[model samples]
Structure formats: C-alpha cells, structure tokens
Target chain A: MTTETTPARVTVGTGDPVLRVRDLQVSYGTPNGDVPAVDHVSFSLQPGQRLGLIGESGSGKTTMATALMRLTRPPGRIVGGEVLLGETDMLKLDEKGLREVRLRDIALVPQGAMNSLNPVMRIGNQMADAIEAHEGRAARKGMEERISAQLARVGLPPTVARRYPHELSGGMKQRAVMAISTVLNPKVIIADEPTSALDVVVQRQVMQTLGRLQEGIGSAVVLIGHDMGLIAQFADLIGVMYAGRLVEIGPVDEMLTDPRHPYTRLLIDSLPKLTAKGKLVGIPGLPPALLNLPQGCAFNPRCPYAFDRCHQDVPAVQQLAPDRRAACHLYPANPALPALPASVQMDAATPLELTGPAMEGQEEVAG
Target chain B: MSATPLLELRNVTKVFQSGVRKTPANMTVALRDASLVLPDGTATATAIAGESGSGKTTMARLLLGFIKPSEGQILYKGVDITKMDKAQRLAYRREVQPIFQDPFEVYNPFYKVDHVLTTPLRNFGLYAGEEQKRIEEALEMVGLRPKETLGRYPHQLSGGQRQRIMVARALLLRPRIIMADEPVSMVDASLRATILDELRKLVSEFGISLLYITHDLTTAYQVCDDIVVLYQGTVTEVGSVEKVIRDPQHPYTRLLVSSIPLPDRTQRWGEDDSAITEEQARRSTSGCRFAPRCARAMEECWTQIPPLFRVDPDRAASCFLRKDAPVLPSEQVGQVLKVMRPGDAGNAPAA
Candidate 1:
C-alpha cells in the first residue's frame, strides 16, 4: 500500500466534532417569496457518531442532507449557515476548494441509489474515478486491488468490480454506492434513505454493512430517512425534523422512551408495534405547508399538547438535559412532557373534523 | 357463518413469459400453487404479507381477474370465476371491490372527486333519488365530510383524503370482500394509523371481509386476523397473525420477523445476518427458495421440496423442521379443517 492512501487513525469523540452546523438555512426561490426548506437548523457530530434525521415527506430531512454538502441545486439556495468541517467553513470555500473537500473529507450517499451511478461508466471506473480525483494517478494493479477490496468491504464480491450498475440488484446497487462513497474514508458520510427501496432482509443487511464500514473507518454518519423504526435501530442519536426546523434531538433511548416534543411523541406513538396490537393511533391533521405556516410553531396545529402560549410565540430550541434538546414551549418549565389529554388522545383514533377553527388553516393549505 | 366461502384460490399458479417464443428458460413463476379461503359471512381480514417480488401482487391481480392463473382455479362462491355468466360476473364485480396502492393515480385529473362515488351508483343502477344521501353516508363511514371532499379535483386533496375517498367508493358498493393492495403504504406515517383504523372499522361495523396485501408486516399484524407469509412465489407460513408473528415457524418468516426494526431502542439488530447472492437464489429453484439462505439447511433441503405441514389446528408451515407434522391437503380449503382437529390429531410438531 502507498503511503499517500494510508488510513488515518483518529480517536473518536475525544476532541472537537468532525462536523458542526450553526443556524443553517436553505430556501427555494419562488415567484411569491423565498420558501425556507431548512430553517435555522443547528447540530454537531462527534467522530464515529451516528445521527439519524427523520421527518415526514415535506419535513425537509432530505433538503438538510443536500444543504449540508452544499449540493443544493438552482431554485434552492443556501441562504445562510456555517457548515464547519473541522473549523473549515464549507460555505466560504471556493469552487475548487469545495470539490477537494467533498469526497476527500465528506461524502454523500444520495437517496436513489439506482439512478445515482453513471450509467455508462463501469463499476471499477467509478471507484477509480473517486480515488484518482483525490490522489493523482496510481499504479493500475494497485488501483484494481483497492477497488476490489472496497467492493469486498461492503460484502460485494470481487466480480462486482467488472459489472455495470444495471447488472446489480437493488441491494447490490446500494452496497456499491456505499463502497464508492467510503473509498476515501471520509470523516462524515451523509446517507439519505440508503435502504428505502429495499425489502426488510436486504435493508437489514445493508444497515449491517453500513455499521461495519463506519466502525472500520471511524467515520460519523448522518442517516436521513422517514422510517422511525429503522432509524431507532440504527442511529445512536435521533433528530426529529418538521417544517424546516429541528424539533427534537437526543440519544436514541431517551428520544424513543421519553420524547419531549409533542410531534416527536406523536410520531413515535404512530408506529405499529409487534409486541402489542391495539387501535392504530395517528397524529391528527397534516403537517403545515412551509409557505403558509401557523402563527407561532409550525406543528402547533397538529400538536396535541399545544397550549395558548404555543400559538402566540415561537419556542426556541432549549437544552433540557445534557445531550438532549427540544424545541417546544412545554420544556424548560415542565420537568417532563405532561400526559396528552384524554380527548386529544381519543381524537388520534378518530378522524378530526375539518370544519373546526384549528383545522381550517391546514385544510386551506391541504386543499 | 355460512357453508360456502366468499372467495377462494385453489392451487393457483401464474407464470409470465419474457421471450418472444414460449420456453421454460425465459418464464418466471410469479405465483405458485397458492390457496386461500375467505369464508362466507365472516368479516375477518387476511393479510398476504411478503417482500417485493414475493408474488403478493400477482395473487391480488389473479383474484381481481386482471390476469388468468396458469395452472389452477380461482372460485367465487362455489363457481369458477372464468366460467361465470354475464349476470354472475356483474354480481362478482359489484361484490368484490379493489382499493389500489396509489390513490393519486386511480383518479382522473379532469373529473371532480364526486365522479368516483357516482360511477359505482350508476353502474349498479342504485342511483335513485337518494344518490346524495348514499354518497354522504358512504363518505361519513370513512370519516370524511361530504361537503369539503366533494366538488374538489384529485390534485386539490391530500394523499390521506384521496385514500379515504377510495375507501368510501368501495363502501358504497356494499361489497362482501375488498381486496386492499398496500392501502396504507403510500400514505404518510401519521396518516397510516387513521387509514388502518378505518379499514378495521369496515370489518366491525359494515361486516366486510378484507384481503389486505402488503409488504409491511407491522401494519399487517395490527389490522389482520390471519396472515399468509409468502416467500418468492410460495406460501411459507399461514396462521393467526398473533400466533404466526409471536412464534414464526418458517425460516423465511423468522428472518422477515426478526429483520423488522422496532421503535424500541433496547433491541438492536445483530450483524450475524449474511446475504445470499442472486446466483444462488436463482439456482435453488428445484428445492426450497430459502434453502440457500437458511441457517439450518440440511443436506436434503437442496433437492427435496417440502410441503406445507399442518403445525396447528389453524396454522401450517412449509419447512423441513416440521417434517413430523402431517402434510396439509391442497385440494379443498374447507377439507383442511376436517382433516385435523385439536386433540384427535395431536401429531403436529411444536413450533
């Protein structure tokens, strides 16, 4: 092995975080106004930490993934934020500097693995391209071995290096993407729904492979998806996003068992359990549209625990305990989230009337 | 409650040919020797649970008469579906309704949401002077206000609303059985529970049997009474959802049940699972489809195909581990109950 490609050994969580985001904001420019997709989001990732970001369809989890890497396309602009990659501000980096820092330090495993790979390029060439772009040209034999090894690391056989993207199955294609993204041993890997299209068996296997890879390279991973069960199983810390804001962020055990935010609690309660079968409970009303949000909190209309103060002023994210933070008016005052009212809990089993004044605002946007 | 079954699939097999000419090499067995029965007068929900390419959709399409089965028969109330007369076919069409997977694609863009509700009434010639009242009642059954949901185009409604409208359309038919194909898969997470609750209400309040086909086992366990676990194109396990999910007998079913990521944090998935290559899966057609990936595979598992073994009075699993259990008769589903009872034939191996 060449000295230039030697793997670096860094102690995990002993020093500064590998990635830190401060008041990040991303907006989509429209004719009416600039619609915020990721609004004032802030978080940090220690070395080897696995953070799973989850939300509904329009909750902007995927947008957070793209904005973190500065890959937001036209019509969507990174309005303001500081994405610090070990003190290097990514937003301030020039074009060439940004490109160099992307795969070399932070890599992105995009949402759709089927369409992410270049159709015309061979699998080996794609791996070689990612490697050659970072480090100049290398010996052909060594390059081939490295490519085969990378594919094998993700559980793909050496023969996979000779095949094209179409020749692989859905699970294999996702593994190939994982292999390519981790070829450089990136400090932070932003994987967005890497296993959405896969079945349960393959999804489990893919998550296992991702876990093994992260342990091998000691890289922090930001996994973004909509499945709470999958995220709870994989992530060390869970962050809930809603309407362009980070609603809850804490350790997985604390987040699932004793979630502080009403939206987080509703989202967790909505999942059907295998151990107990009961009436399926869902959050009443739909998530508000970003363009026409409510007066205070975006989730105020759907929140079962919303009080009078929640409708008048926005609640800033407050630290409830060490390593736990939630953006809700109930926290910092109440020691814990109070039990949901019996009437509100009953409404979860029954459908809400759309004619109610609280639901009228959401109906207009939904209609 | 009745002697005859509402709907039945008897040894049905469907194969699709890919090449221009008919050949065994290019044919794909979408469904193989599947049999199920929805007894008449019972409102139980049976879930056909499987992963993608496991032939759950093929079973649904075969029941809907969208495609003909290659080998066996699909019967509706003691008569073969393909042999039904015009009047019988119309009755079948009116009694058996379908709730498609994608609610958005089922609607026409140009028509208002009222079009879906009115078409069924006009088709059955039930649109007397109470057309408005009937539509309103059906909509109210699924918990949708008739005023706001009517007169709106498909694009103007949310996914949850559109799905509720589809449920209302099915309810208007007063169907005996509704084949809901992945009804809650496309909806948002928070809305999924609401839709599932509505489906459960159909069975309790309206006395409608539901054939729920889906790849999600959690939702299936919640809403279904009995479960049929399909692997590839074959039935691996079938029983009460409670018993089957609690103690899965088939190797594939066990793998599927264990693979589901629960919301609890104390239980984490182990890294011991190893995936089989596509080549191995394709080559093991002569034997069990899961033999290549089975952790307890024996030498005989590679060549001999196991029959569905009667493991319980109401349960059956196709696996070599239950070899001592009696083979379930495949001819008639009603005969299955008579062939084995609880104490008379206490020969089934413990799960």
Candidate 2:
C-alpha cells in the first residue's frame, strides 16, 4: 500500500488516487470448503491513470474486478476488503447506496458483448435505460440527443441507435456496450476483457474509444485481460496476478524492460513479439490450483530462481523501486533483487524443464 | 523446392447459401478467387491472416476437403484433390491433417482421451504395431508427458494440455502439411507460446510445412515464413512475413499492421480518421472488397478489380497503388472475371 503514496519516478498522473483497494479478499463457498478466489490484493488508481491487470484464467483477475464493483454473484463472497471510491467505502454501502454509486461513480464494460446487450431491446433504449435508472425520466426529449452523443463518442454512427443488437456487427455491438456503460460518466471504469473475441483491427478501435472516453471523463480505469501486448500498449501501470495474488505491480515500461518477479518475466518472454521472431517460450508448469496451493510461494514449482526460503515462507509484497512492488524471495527488503541466473537471462526460450529443486513431489493433476 | 508445390489452391472460390430457398440474394461468397502455393521439399509455415468473416476459415475448410469449392481446383502435388478417387482421397487425407480451434469441443466426452490418439492410428492403418511407442513419441515431441496425458478423460485435462494432445495426434500421422486453424486462440495466454513453439518445432524438427490460419497477426509474424492477408474473401497481400509486416504495401495490410497492439510502450496506435463501416463493405459488390474501408480508395478502386500486382519479386498487393508494378501471372485475369464489367476486358492485365 506504501507504493500508492510514493511519487512515481515517471509521471503516472497528478492527483490523489480516486480508487483504492486495500487487502481485498474474495472466496467461493464450495461443498468441500471455502476457496479463496482473490487473495489479499491491494492497489490504487489515480484519476485518469490506466492500470492493467494481466493474468491467466483462474488467476483471480475477474474475481477482483467483480469484487471491486460489488458484483460478486452467489457462491462467490467478498470476505474482507476496503474498496474506497473517493471518500465512501464501497464495501460499507447498502443496496440502495450501492445502486446509486455503481453507474454514477463506477461502471463496468463486461466481456461478452453479445450476451450483455438485451436481444430485443433497441440500442437507444439500452443506453436510455442506463441513464434513466439513475436519472429521473422527466427530461424525455433530451435523452435521445444524449443517446446519439454517447453513440458518436465511441465512433458509432447515430443510425446505430435505431437498430437491434443483432443488426449491428461485432465491433459495433462492442462500441454500443461501451457507450451504454459510460453514459453516466462514472469515475471508475472496470473493463473486463472488452476485446477478447474481437479481431485485432476492431480491438484496436475499441481500445482507442475506451481510452478517449476515459480521458474525456477523467476517470481511472482498471482494464483486465490475458493479452500482454494489449496491456502493455494501453496501460500506464501494469499489475501481474498469479494464484489469486498480485505478484508484481509497476510502470509498464519498467515491468516490460526489467521485471522483478520471475513469473512476470516468464509471462513477458512467452508472448510472441512483432519486433523480433524466434523460438517461443512458455511457463513450464501449470498455475497452482487455488483450492490446493503450495505451502510457500505459489509460483515456486515453476520459477527457475526460487530458493530454499521461497518454499517455506510466503513472500509478502515488497517495494522494490519507488513505483514498483513484487512478491518474490529473489528481492529482499535491504538488498534489492540480486542478479538472476544466466539461463533466464539468455533468451525468451527457456529450457522446457528448467525449475528449482522445490518442484519435487508436486503432484501435477493428470486427466 | 520441387517442380510441383506440396499443396496448391488455384483460383478457388466457395459460396454458401444463406437462406433455405436457393436464391442469388441469399448466396454468400465465403471465398473469392483465393490462390495459394506451398512449395515442396522444404518446410515452411504460411499464415492466412484475417478477421472474422474475412473468409480465412473458408479457405482452411476448402483445403481440408470439408467442403467443395464452387470454382477452381485444389491440387496436391500437381494432382487435383477434388477429382481423386477413394484410395487417392484417403491418401490425401493422410498427407494433410487439421488442428481445430476449440480444443474442448473436438473431443467426445464419452471416451477417454486415448481414443483421440488411437483412433487416428487405426484409421490411417498405422496401429498394427508399435502404436504405444508412436503415440508416446508424438506426445513427447509436443512437450506432453505420456504419464500425465494418457489414460485420462478429456474433461480432466486443461485446455492447453488438450490442445497439445491435438497437436500430438496430428503429428502421429507424420503428415507432410498441417492445417492448424486458430490452434492457440482458445488456450490460456501462458500456454499459447508453448503450443506455438510446438507448432514451430513441427517445421524444423519433423520437416513438415504448416498452414497456420488465424486472426492474430503477431503470432503469425513470430512463427511463419510467409503471410497471406485476406479481407472479406479477397487476397489483399502475399509476401514474406518480414517484408509484409515490416513494410505493409496494401492499405488493408497497413491497417492490420497498425492495428495490432504491440508490447512496446513507446509506439502506440495512431488515431483512425476514416469511418469505413461494414455496411459500406456489404454494398460494394463489384469493386475491390476492401475499397469501402480502404483509406486509399480511388476512382479505379470503385469499378475495376485490381489483380495481385508485384510489389517485389516475391511480394504482391491487390491495390491500384501498385498499378505500375508487374502483375503476377498466376490466376490474375481469370480470377478477377467475376467483378469485371461487360466491356472491362480492355483494361485487363497482360498475361
């Protein structure tokens, strides 16, 4: 949490953070027992700052996003956390208060555009419903103009308002969804993989629209996705999640250039780059199951540089630089991170079986 | 390279009827005059890059013989596959294999995962003996341990694991060419690189050519030797990955290259000014398929269809910007005949 107050070496943004999440914990109540989907994760976002949370499936990125908006469904409960949006604690808000704060203060651009939009509802009605839910329906004539403006904001033509969801293309539907979510001009936008199923060109256009809207509204954004390239290109700050934990959080340039966490480094290296082409590298073992995690560090079984201490004690999130934080044994508080092994420094393509001695007896689940 | 290409699609086009009734209004041209060549005697990976509805999948299905092309021929080693008999068709199926997009849907939940590996062996008549050895070798080649993957249900394995097993199954046949359609799109991000690496290894280690069909251009650029960029069933650009990605000549190719979200922070995506809607693309029936969305659309682009003009010795782009460049002699005039006006023969390129 100290990293939130620290003046970043690079000018991330100039303002007190509008959204702060402290020790956020979310769990799913299963028949066997309680399974923590999101561990004690903490981060803050200054107004107009773009924070990208990158993780693989079941890494708790979506869980954290839903929890921030108090949208955790049944079986998934927010056990502990303080979601401070401006001055009010979102966790303390009642249903009525939460509804008011949701769209007016915080909005969500959900992943699947096809399922998110109502099939029968016209695009303009969908946008109107979002506005009329918070704003009273007295100003009926102005709603049409507002709807067209929102549509035009995301690059959709005004004619799109007359059509149904099925009538529009995939990109148009996604842009329409964006328009609906931002109609209220919320202070924080939680876009959960808005471009997952879209094509590369359309994905670019959608991201640009989101960026432009965020800038116009001066809202902090928490963009969650699995694509490393997309996160790096759009976000100012990057947060890498693993096994329901924020393994590393830092500036995008710094994290990509010199990553402190081993998982972050391996994940970055795994991505196929446009700048260069070579043998592709992927993380060796599968991510640890959330229900049955390793005793010490969750990533110990796959990390090449993991040592003895990493297997016995869980590493707390430690501040490595003025603006960066990582949870790894390689970087102690007093001496910063030591030099990594030569094997990891060589190329993106690490040997298939490169792992520390801690990997012994880890029962990898078989099909 | 050999005298004949390993597999060649000579001016192929596929049209699908959209409505229950047989009508031209309901006909959707899934593919239009798409041609490709995979040289023999050398291992290469060629990527067919396009977005959804761009006819990339149609081209893949055509090559795999899942559907017949309405026009042109699909040749294998200079012999037409569509005209082949039962024995030749079986042989052709063995020579070319497919790795589908969704790893989960491909498997039947009723059977254990081993059925996937063994059934192919039996069908190809390679399971008479040493079946276990061959299966293990294929799995190991794709970085899957036989102990972890074998004797398990498809549900028990991860998406990445299932995809790797599919790659292993494809390898078991020792096919000359593997047609992988979006092989890694369904897998997790961390596992995508592993699957792509395995696909790359099939080229270098096993001496097999790869026809990688996907919308993701970054991965294509990373692993492929050459690329064919398609836009709404039309082949817009074809060249080596280096030349095409580094310096895109076609306007559509340029848009695609610029649209990809790279990892580098310094270079961000430029703002798009042109408003090229999908409706406009649907309306343009005769001109270049991408002219509606193309930033460099001209008067000629609206009427006459442009052939693949030679940007370089090995590169070609279907754009009027390359009008002065020599036209590729391969299926140029014949392929564009569908879009030609009644008296447009005078403007046709010299063969």
Best candidate per lDDT, number? Answer: 1
Candidates' DockQ values? 0.47, 0.36
Clash counts for the predictions, in order: 0, 1
Error of 2 at B137 (Å): 1.3
Q: Encode model 2's per-residue lDDT on A242-344: one tens digit a residue.
A: 9899999999988998888989988887888888786687777777667677889989878888879989999999888777899988776445445667765
lDDT of 2 by residue, B1-351 (tens): 456767888889899998798797899988888888776776777899998899999999899888999999999988898889999899899989999998878999989999999998898899688999999888888877787678878777777788888999999998999999999887877778888987887887787889999888998988787788889898888877777888999998999888888887666776663565666655564778878887668878888888889777557888999999988754542222211213432221110
DockQ of candidate 2, scored on C-alphas against the true complex (2 decimals): 0.36
In the range B281-312, model 1's lDDT, one tens digit per residue, is 55654778778888777767788877888887
> What are the per-residue Cα lDDT tens digits for candidate 1 across A150-261?
9988989899888999999999999999999999999999999889888888988888888778888988999998889988888888999998899999988889989999
Residue pairs in collision within model 1: none
